[model samples]
Target: GRLLNALAATGNEKYLEGFGPPAPGYKHAPLNNTNVVRDMVDDETAGILVEPIQGEGGIRATTTQFLKDLRAICDEFGLLLFYDEIHTGFGRTGKMWGYEWSGVKPDVAAIAKGMGGGFPIGAFMATEKAAVGMVPGTHGSTYGGNPLATGVANAVLDELLKPGFIDDVAKKGEYLKGQLEGLVKRHPSVYTEQRGMGFLQGIQCAPAVPAGDMVNRLQSLGMLVPPAGENVVRIFPALIADKAALDEGIDILGKAAQSFEAAKAAE
Candidate 1:
């Protein structure tokens, strides 16, 4: 449906043969990468869009090999590779960009979520050639590059580019993941497993226990996590969060899971 909508909006014949089944995990809703590129899009004209780390799609991290293959495929077809790293950029993924994990360079990339630390901002970065066709006035934004926003973004980038900031994000993310894994082990009935990478993590729980209830419970306990696809709780703490903050958040999450387990056991 999404691809169809995109194709319809573009009104380009390029999407005719660029159709592929869903990748491996979605066998029930098969969307192959090749079919997507070859049938639904014009091999030479259309661009390939992907989320390096799908923040809302259950925090699913794309496999390194899959990303590399996508890059290779895009290069072969003269297609642009675009990465939607809105939620994974600015050290959130323990790297400056989530695509770094796959060692793939996208022709175009979009980011926003973590750029302003909570302020509203959206950004798109592209290779010189990818943006070459865009003439001045072809696109303009009232706030896209406002001086104030630009200054803030510059500061954010400067801070993130510091030698140890991203490295710290990596270390803290590992710690958080380990803590969440332990919680899963201790509360097996409430959580099935831990998934995701960097500071983006999800706890897959039983469907009977609504993610809303968990979110409310965590909120009551002074913690906030988002609901991911299916019945999972997504955790995306600020990259600047430290060990103590992570521990506190994990404790709150563990308590919430235990409470859910107790309620389920009673039922």
Candidate 2:
């Protein structure tokens, strides 16, 4: 489908194989390592595009120090910093936006997904200066400005911005995280410590059990977790999910892990 590959640009090997090399204007930086960022960027570089918390590339996060360093480096090098918060926005990361945790603002931000409250809409924001080149009448879309989409989006924003809505998301994320950590302790063979913040988390599995295998098992248990790089089973829970529901989901995943272990032992 067009939607499946529209988000298609990555330095990942699988992407390289499928898409035949990355686009010309991009550079790859190790998630939390700014040295690689410095080494790869040069005078010709226009800006840096980063994800505050990686989703499909695995549940990786950038350290606050690294994010701060990027801000400083981008300033020194005069590069615009863009954040792809498509997955981390709208309370997915417990924070209104994942970059908020580092206290570093992006010059431009791409956001979507949960922002629609089940409807489909995505938008990119830029600081006034950064947006100067985007003349008002030059850029326009047909379906993009449709009243129905815009109205639903506006209503969704009202709910997301309501007092204590974001706070509850952060607290629920903590609860879910604590439960996942317990699973790691109980089944060290099948799992590793959780990766990710808030409601977006992943369970790293050992090579003995592939992440795809766990994804299959979890599907059977009524959970539809996705797989990420380095053998990770990702769980992206709804922002409004409560502690009880999160616990039940995690419990089902734990049982799935145990079942996988037993099946492996029998082999």
Candidate 3:
């Protein structure tokens, strides 16, 4: 947690107050800016870690060119490139892996969340060269690689790898994006923009519409959208949801916005 706090640029300071300082040497840079990252790297740097699409940080996505530049920078500096794919793995982003969007593979990747299809399991994968130091005894956990978790993960993969499954996700995601854009246009007083990819989407609230208020309003109306940083409301539907389900969600979201606008007018 401390290390994550150090690596994160926002929304981590409160949790780190009582904890001693986070591990040293980790540096942070603005998202999608390769030049800032290049300037921060030096002889002491060992690796670079990033999320292809930030989940809690308002669902911001890294540009393809920025990812490519990071790959090239890692090669030039002899540093390992790492990806935190916990939120974007297992077809969440309409791809088997989020890094697929950039075509720049990471030397190491941390994956979890959807890997076990609701089962509690997490793992880190590395290339053969990057994993040279991980011998049999070097790393072990009481429940790591247990048969049940691995079995569940394999079954999940089997379903995810089925023909047309990922493509359907992509198609539905585009449809959802278009609907969200329409929602923003219709409710200009409540929402300013929509962001993110695939099932992971965020609706940025207008300055007068607090994300927390919108989340509560949606929940009261039989919906549950979470609040994210920068006054964005996160909307992650189940991967198996069909167009009908998505339409229902969008309808509820629109109603919530309409209610907010009504209240504002009355005020």
Q: Which candidate comes out best when scored by lDDT?
A: 3
* RMSD of candidates 1 onward, in order: 6.3, 2.2, 1.8
Q: Considering lDDT, where higher is better, how would the candidates rank from best to worst? A: 3, 2, 1
Runs of candidate 3 with Cα error greater than 4 angstroms are 1-11
Q: lDDT tens digits, residues 1-267, model 1?
A: 235553443233445346533222211111235545454544335667777776655777777776777788788778888888887888888888988988889999988878877777788899999999889888877766888877788888888898899988888888888988898889877787788878877888876777778889999999877787767889988777888888899889888887887887798
The TM-score ranking, best first, is 3, 2, 1
Better of 1 and 2 by TM-score: 2
Candidate 2: tens digits of C-alpha lDDT, residues 169-221? 88888888888898999989899769987888888998888899888888988
TM-score for each of the candidates:
0.85, 0.93, 0.95
Please estimate how well model 1 matches the true structure, expressed as its whole-model Cα lDDT: 0.76
Return the top candidate by TM-score.
Answer: 3
